[model samples]
Target: MSQSRILVTGGSGRLGQMVLDQLLHAGVSGIITTTRTPDKLGAYASLGVDLRHADLNDPQTLSKAFQGADRLLLISTDDLFSGRRVQQHTNAIDAAKRAGVRHIHYTSMPEPEASTAIPFSSDHVATEATIRESDLSYTILRVAWYAENPVELGLIPAALRTGTWLTSAGAGRIAYVTRSDVARAAAAALVRDKETSQIYDITGPHAMSAAELAAALSRSVDRPIEVRQVDDTALARELVASGVSPQLAPMLVTTDANTRAGNFERVSHAVQELTGVPPTSFESFLVKNKARLLGATDK
Candidate 1:
């Protein structure tokens, strides 16, 4: 039998919703999900999910939400761009420890210290360390690139439309895992009894570069799209001009450099091994989201 009760925090988030759905699909009956705004979680409510009101920033609220839960899915807080996000994560971890949760499942970045040089990566890296050091059984699900990342929908499509894909990730490949795949892996880990201190680098099968992705989009949309390698200085300028934080400009540049350096270059079999199904491939991802992505190509 699964845990008596499985509690998922941030259940309303994109990945969180998928995790919740997969857990229900897996026949886990006693599922408890927490959201800051319970009223907004109408769909989950209709599914007979016990909704608890709790903000990740407040340990008292988290403790109440986590009580009586044998398993806890600590969906990483979405306030990465905010200044207080790290503190918010600390508060949630503290509450999990206080509640004596049996297993703490964390949704973390894949090589947060190395990927895309985003500021959030540092936060995830620190959180992973905190989870490891804490006196609790933990499963670290280090997620690789999410195929549905905004870059896929926004910048990539925009670049395709203009017939110009500009980035410093020249020929660098990444195993872009889907949100569903990551969710499935996390849900699978939650239901299983594994030794503590287990770390799984969840990734997809294929590793494609920006140029290759551009080619895929071109084929999908029936257009000629070209990938242009922009220098770090130009990349920083473009990001800043696009209203991206000046503070984060350097981070993006660093990330592009890391990509070129082949940081996110590995494909992991963890997903297939854990879920008994291969993780979604980048081509499959492009096919499914072809509408959303190609929709932008029309404009």
Candidate 2:
């Protein structure tokens, strides 16, 4: 199959780095990767990747960096609290247009417009609009909550220590997809010979509630973890008291609120359809990371 120069923005990021690896594993060449710090991607450069320095905050950099790229993967920016994420995204979209990039790919969350809890959801809503309004052939991957979110945030560790899994989701369920799986699906979309305007909701096979997830955590860590549900306000208060920063506590609380609103309760075949392989189960993901979550084990 012929290859076009596929440019992956934020190539040094967690998801973007994984997408680059998947692209290489697929033997897809003519790859262009952009990050703010090009020196950090020495390994990818060694693999014949065209590394460029691009910053979403700087439109001129992006315009120059995206040159000659047929496809572009705009991994959503990570400025959760800055409130400038949408503007940053717009800069990239405009840069892609200036560079004349044909197809654009985006990573987004599910039901952003319906998300009353997450203030950042509007950022995605605007980004999607900008992408569509650009008239570029695009693929939007509405990725679900990452299974690693609990672990990446301080939640899993706190729960394991206190034997109390705290949440404000009530009975809300979410299909938490893994980061690698999301990355694979995004990569698969970019490399396809038939690119078109499409949106795919990438989710795990099963929708699980906080209790179910707590049970999984209990089993993984070999401990009894009891789910402790509270109101969103109370949860935020407790989170801040437990050492979470005031800035981030609200965002964490709202994830549960959004879940309660049924924004994330979904199960889809998009991952399997895109990658030709069923996404890994949540149980499998926990088992694989149990060691890390558990920290040191008995020798």
Candidate 3:
């Protein structure tokens, strides 16, 4: 197989970093990554990755950064609150087309076309449409929720502290895939040979409900954790009280409401098929990050 000159945006980000590492490990040569600040990515440069300055909000930098790259991993920017993320993504797509990029692998949400309940889904749906219209061979990776989200956002820690997990998502199950697994899938897709646009629902092997998640947390931490389902209004109030911004509280509540409506219940084998490894389960993720979940510092 001929090696594709790969360029990845958001390479310094959480998931993007994982994708970069996976590409390097897979021996994918001629890899390039773009960052607004090249000095911040000196380590990647030392590893022989071509680091360039490219900002999604700045269209002039994108074409030069994408020059000579056949495949581009366009990691979606996390500017949901500003309502300009879709525009930024469209800018990237347009620049990729102008630079003659052949294939684009985008990180999108699972089944964004099915629901308008998730506020961020609109950005992804619009971006996917733009990519389709760009005449580029594309791979749309519809990723599931990350297992690390709950732990990183203080949800699990709050439950551990209060002995109760408060949720507006009643009886809704999510097939949570870890960030590492998603990155691996992205790496696989970037190098694979394909003639047509493909969409992959990158999800975990199975789905688990809120109650099941609480029970798993209890078992992992060796404590009793209770599940409390509340309405969106009550959830929003609690979120605000817990230091979440007043403006963002309602969005979080809506996320749970969407979950309860079963928008995140799809499970898929795409992770294994793409990365040659099964997606990590929620139970295993919790066990692996037990110290972090239990508020213990790494030694």
TM-score of each: 0.90, 0.95, 0.95
Clash total of candidate 3: 0
lDDT of 3 by residue, 1-299 (tens): 44879999998889888999999999888899998888888898888899999999999988899899989999999888798899899989999999988999999998787757887888999999999999999999999988887766656766777788888998888888899999999998888887479999999888888899999988987889999898988987886665555765665676687788888999989989987899988988898988877763221
Worst 10 residues of 3 by lDDT: 290-299
Clashing pairs in 3: none
Best by lDDT: 2
Q: 51-160 in candidate 2: lDDT tens per residue?
A: 99988888878878999998999999898778889999999999999999999999999998998688888999999999999999889899999988877666777677
* Clash tally for model 1: 1
RMSD of each: 2.6, 2.0, 2.0
Give candidate 2's TM-score.
0.95
- lDDT (C-alpha, whole model) for all candidates: 0.78, 0.88, 0.86
TM-score of 3: 0.95
Candidate ranking (TM-score, best to worst): 2, 3, 1
What value does the lDDT take at residue 177 in candidate 3?
89
Candidate 1: regions farther than 4 A off: 150-153, 236-255
Model 3, position 213: C-alpha lDDT score? 91
Q: What's model 2's overall lDDT?
A: 0.88
